[model samples]
Target: MLVRLVYASRASRELSPQDLQDILRRSRDHNPAEGITGLLWYNDGVFIQVLEGGRDPVNARYKRIVMDNRHDAPILLTYQEISERRYAGWSMGQVNLHRLNPGLLLKYGETQKLDPYRMSGAMLTALFDELVSSGAIECA
Candidate 1:
């Protein structure tokens, strides 16, 4: 089954431009080999990411992410098992930080601070469309 996890974290002020670049590079490199795919969005002081893939690989990646010293402990905002792959067209996808906004964030339930499971398919589609349009994430 394909699994999707949406998460957010507070970025540290110490994070430098080079550091962010490195993290993005590493994420791109890691995803494809592990059979993982997703988009990462950053704004304000938060890093929000959506990961989708096999259960084992996805879980393992999440473990590594939580242990990584670069990012703070991420809060798992939502999780869902989907019948289809939303980002199958991309390998190790990414979304740039500049494209993030309140509307985009709301797609992930930021405005209401609610769970994604409660969201409708239209809402999810809107969120995915925004990510695709942003053209933020790059494949390694």
Candidate 2:
């Protein structure tokens, strides 16, 4: 069965631009073969991502993510069987928070900041859907 998993984590330490690139590179290289597709959003020290694929592959990937030393306090935000992939076009698209409108953020969130911890998984999902529609996602 197909599943969609969303999670948020904090960086263990200050991440350099190269560090972020490495992560995306690895995901792009590795996900397609596993039938995975998703989007990654990073801002400040926080990371919020969506992974969609078969149950086993998605679960395995999340397990590895939880064990990765670069992340701290990883929190599973949402996981459920899905009828279709919302981000099938991207192996791992990236949300460009820099280009995001603050008004859009405020529409779903309490503040202009993107804080996954403070928002419900449904809220984040809706925001992501809007982002996709708005062409705010940068291709991986």
Candidate 3:
């Protein structure tokens, strides 16, 4: 089954160019090797990512992410199983960085305050669009 997860974590520090480079390198190495795919969005001192793949691989990656020192206490904002792949061709996936502002996010109907699982795909898509328009992410 294809599974999708949306999660957020607090960064240990403001992301530097080198930090971004390292993440890009690691993501490129991990995605194809593990059959993982997803999108990552950095904003407001938080790293929000969406990962999809087989249950085992995805879960394993999530476990490792939870333990990684780069982030602190990863929070699973959303998780679900889907019949279709939203991001199928992505290798280590796409990374988009956005300037974090609560007010800007709130324009999307309390996104920062709401539970991720409670959001519908349309809502998620809306947020994704906003991020893209704001230059927070680039499509793969």
Candidate 4:
């Protein structure tokens, strides 16, 4: 069965554009071989990421992420078995939320700011759904 895991993290320091590009490059390169597909959004020093694949591998990836030094305080927002992938085409879709919309943010347990650590699991999922539907994010 496929599994989905969502989590949020704070960057240890401000990241340059090159740093973000490297992360996306690595994600795109590695995810496909492991059957993982998901979305990642980074803004205001926070990162919101979802990973979907076999339960074991997905969990394993999350473990590695927890140990990664680029980020701090990784908090899991959700995890579950899924009937289908919400992100199937892109290995790692990227969202741009630097200029957030308050109305949409409120719909997903968010304020005018982007703070995934403060959201509930269900709300995080709903926010991801919104990201997909509105093309707020796109594939790298």
**Location of the lowest summed lDDT over 10 successive residues in candidate 4:** 96-105
lDDT of 1 by residue, 1-140 (tens): 78887776667666676776787788777678888888765545566677889999888888877886656757776678888877776655666545455566565665834234455444554676676877745554
Model 3 per-residue lDDT tens digits across residues 2-25 = 788777788887888778768867
Candidate 3 weakest ten by summed lDDT: 92-101
Give the top-scoring candidate (TM-score).
Answer: 2
- lDDT score of residue 109 within candidate 4: 60
Question: lDDT values of the candidates?
Answer: 0.68, 0.93, 0.70, 0.86
TM-score of model number 3? 0.74
| lDDT, candidate 4, 1-140, per-residue tens | 89999999999999998999899999999999999999888887898899999998899999999999997999998999999998898899998664345678877664667578678878878877887787677775
Model 4: residue 106 alpha-carbon error in angstroms: 2.2
- The TM-scores of all predictions, comma-separated, are 0.72, 0.97, 0.74, 0.93
Where in model 1 is the C-alpha error above 4 Å? 97-126, 133-140
Q: Estimate the overall C-alpha local distance difference test score of candidate 1.
A: 0.68
Using TM-score, rank the candidates from best to worst: 2, 4, 3, 1
RMSD of each: 4.3, 0.8, 4.1, 1.5
